[model samples]
Target: MTEKDPRYRRAASAVKRCVAGEVFLVPVAAGVADVMSLYVLNPTAEVIWDLLDEPRSLNEICEHIQQVTGEAGGHVREDCSNFLTQMERMGLVERA
Candidate 1:
């Protein structure tokens, strides 16, 4: 992705909770509870989630993931992109 790819931040109304060493994204709004389901993030997703506590570019997230997991750049980029896209679709994250 290019630098033009927008950075993302956690949604204003979403709350994060940890249970049994896993992180979950909980939507908190009147109709949100009914419409949006809670998202349980895996260990790798948890790393991305923590990095997303603030606005960050996809490249930045990929770099961090690579550093943390010692993975290949292309692999990390694809994985992070997919995760971010899913989170954005679920309204857990927004363009920053």
Candidate 2:
């Protein structure tokens, strides 16, 4: 990857928890039952979140997802981009 490639890291303040088959991101200061700051992740979003455990470029993230899902189209790229945008807005992830 090039040096200019965008890399993303999960926010330290956003803790991830998987409960009853659903993935949730709750703020560190927020109670587990708090719904206000809680973010529920869909399956694709959960996959994207899992991939962001470490810093990774958008290209790499989409490529990995595509490989696993066997999707050879632009949808993976769009989905990853949108998910990252939402994560950033929610303070669940950051550009690294």
Candidate 3:
């Protein structure tokens, strides 16, 4: 699909903010104590995470990034779509 499906969504306040020096992810499932894990994301993945702070559709995110960076550089949209899909699979985002 040229445009992303509008059903994708993200969990609210699910991400814990930490110091800016380094980026890390801590996944803590509610009603399931002692099941926390920390995930380390690379620079590109970190960018995706930052974008995901708000519930934005994949297409919208890609467009924003392209506009902000002033360079698609080729395949940015596809890369962003893939990143968004991965985030959804990782439970970092949900489908609305």
As a whole number from 0 to 100, the lDDT of residue 73 in candidate 3 is 46
Q: Per-candidate TM vs. native?
A: 0.84, 0.84, 0.66
How high a TM-score does candidate 3 get? 0.66
lDDT of 2 by residue, 1-96 (tens): 566578998987787788898889887655444457888888778888888889999998988888888997598898888888888987779988
Sorting all predicted structures by TM-score, with the top scorer first, yields 1, 2, 3
lDDT by residue for model 3 (11-63), tens: 55245445576666666567342235656676666766777666667676677
Question: Candidate 1, residues 1-96: lDDT per residue as tens digits?
Answer: 455778988887777788787788788886455325778888888888888889999988988888889998987898889888988887888888
Alpha-carbon lDDT, every model: 0.83, 0.83, 0.64
lDDT of 1 at 77: 90
lDDT of 3 at 84: 68
Q: What lDDT, from 0 to 1, does candidate 1 have? A: 0.83
- Runs in model 2 with CA error above 4 Å? 1-4, 30-34
